[model samples]
Target: MTHPLVKRYNLAPHPEGGFYRQVFRSENETSSYIHGETRPALTHIYFLLLKGKVSRFHRVLHDEVWNHYEGAPLQLFQLHQQQLWERRIGGQGNEYAEVVNAGNYQAAQSMGEYSLVGCTVAPGFDFADFSFIEEPAMKQWLDIAHPDLAKFI
Candidate 1:
């Protein structure tokens, strides 16, 4: 089936060194994002995968819940006490589960989905959640891409 255009989300940097992202319809995995700091009560994130799956390899700085809006299926996992505990939350094992304390977990091709919504507390989520985790340390790219979001820090 023909899908929507793949989005190119790019955050800009500030004079000093920080990052920020535009707030837009998360479902619109095509083209859009708002400027300035946005803490949405329910910020939905859509992952348009080139392959059939997507990898959200990182940690949820703030406790959040994910609802699979659209995709093949989802395998949610988390790092609790430095241990990996996984489960097939989308198949027969369970249905519509929320991952907790997700840190350094590789949801690689396993994280199958084109879109998912991460609901957080009011005034919304900041950089703590935008971690493009490559390894142990956070790359801290947003700080250089969109300093505006980092300004809040």
Candidate 2:
């Protein structure tokens, strides 16, 4: 069955898993300072996750903020320099918005049937700046460091 967000936003399969549609892209370009290059100032997307689906661990060059719009709560996990942080993005959680820092490995999934969320990226998002942690490498890292945190991936 198609989720309402999938239908409304014309979301497509995202490399990270689940579905997403790019809804906004800034016209102005800005220097990242860190990247030492000019890029879109910002970008926005509508992201959807269905039950049993998870957004695989990945990292981007720019910070991302997620806004809970509707549906069930979503679990977001961030692996930062070997530290694991968990946050719920919806429902009765203390926060409805969460930020994932640039260069940190992050992932997410729906707690129920589905979750409709929005993501905003500063410095925009380019495929060239995206990196996915392969399962093999992740398993190896988890085996020695964060075995208990593997479930989030």
Give me the candidate number with maximum lDDT.
Answer: 2
lDDT of 1 at 90: 41
- The local lDDT score (0 to 100) that residue 5 gets in candidate 1 is 26
Off by over 4 Å in 2: 134-138, 144-153
**What digit string (tens of lDDT, one per residue) describes model 2 on residues 41-106?**
999999998998899889988999999998899999988766778899899845889999988889
C-alpha lDDT of residue 17 in model 1: 20
Please write out the lDDT profile of model 1 over residues 8-98, one tens digit for every residue.
4443331212222334333322211333344454443433332343444455444455544444445544444435455554444466656
Q: What TM-score number comes out for model 1?
A: 0.46
* Cα lDDT computed for each candidate against the true fold: 0.40, 0.86
Q: How does candidate 2 score on lDDT?
A: 0.86
**TM-score, per-candidate, Cα-based:** 0.46, 0.90
* Model 1 bad stretches (over 4 Å): 1-42, 48-53, 91-93, 102-123, 132-153
Model 2 weakest lDDT span, ten residues long: 144-153
